[model samples]
Target: MNPTIRSLVVPVTDLAATKAVYSALFGEPHTDESYYVGYNVNGFEIGLNPAGNGGGPVAYADVDDLDAARDALLAAGATERDAPNKVAPGVRVCVLADADGNPIGLRGK
Candidate 1:
């Protein structure tokens, strides 16, 4: 599958403060939920999550096939940090850790 890094998610300890900062930086949020806030900037998505698990930001690649992309990553020595799971009706996301334990996110529709 051809994947592109279209999203970047940052973990925040303070949701309100973080949301305000991102809102100021990116104009306004496209999505505002208790768990996640998303902003669209020139076709790319910037997301903020209070419950995010990783140590730093996660870059999410947009993929046509979530399973295929995940399998390919695993085959290439990436460890699964989170299995592919549906976040919305048609959106699915998975997390993988690189050799250095950096988190990478995969999103599919």
Candidate 2:
């Protein structure tokens, strides 16, 4: 599958404050939930996650096959942080950590 970095997730300490900041910056959120807030900017997604890494932001690449992409990462020395899980009706996401323990996310539909 061709990988495209379509999303960038930022870890937030305060969801409401973070959402407001991003809303002002991005002109409003397309997705607003207790756990996540998503904004669409020129077809790219910027997400705020309450349960994100404190270290830094996580970048997500869009893939045609979530499992295949995840497995390839694992084979290349990445460790599974979260298995493939359905977040929406047709959307599936998986999180993995590189050798240095940095988080990377994969999203598929």
Candidate 3:
């Protein structure tokens, strides 16, 4: 699939409090764990990561080829915030920073 921003991850200091707020807005989460909590708001994902990004939410663009896409972004001056890692079976994710230090996440199969 072409890259599209469909997933958003927010780093939180207080998981319980933040989870409550998101739950109220988006209903119950589809995936819940101590490391990560994810809600499926329609097709898009609203995630709460207690130990993810330090700043704001990171929007993830779903891509077909993770390595190729990441390399292209690096060539265009996007710095690597995090290397590609598998979060689930057949699913890999990585974070990159644009020129302004804004995070950009990529997820692929």
Off by over 4 Å in 3: none
TM-score of 2: 0.90
Candidate 3 lDDT by residue in tens digits, 1-109: 3789998999999999999999999888998899999999889999999988696999999999999999999999999999999999999999999999999999996
Lowest lDDT 10-mer window, candidate 3?
Answer: 1-10
lDDT of 2 by residue, 2-93 (tens): 89999998989999988888888898899989989999999999999898757688888999989888889999999988788898899998
Q: Tens digit of lDDT per residue, candidate 1, span 1-109?
A: 7789999999899989999888888987989999999999999889998888858899999999898888899999999988888888999998999999989899996
- Give per-model TM-scores: 0.93, 0.90, 0.95
Instruction: Flag regions of model 1 displaced more than 4 Å.
Output: none
Candidate no. 3 TM-score: 0.95
For model 2, what is the alpha-carbon lDDT of residue 107? 94
Spell out the clash pairs found in candidate 2.
none
Q: What are the RMSD figures for all models against the true structure?
A: 1.1, 1.4, 1.1
Pairs in steric clash, model 1: none
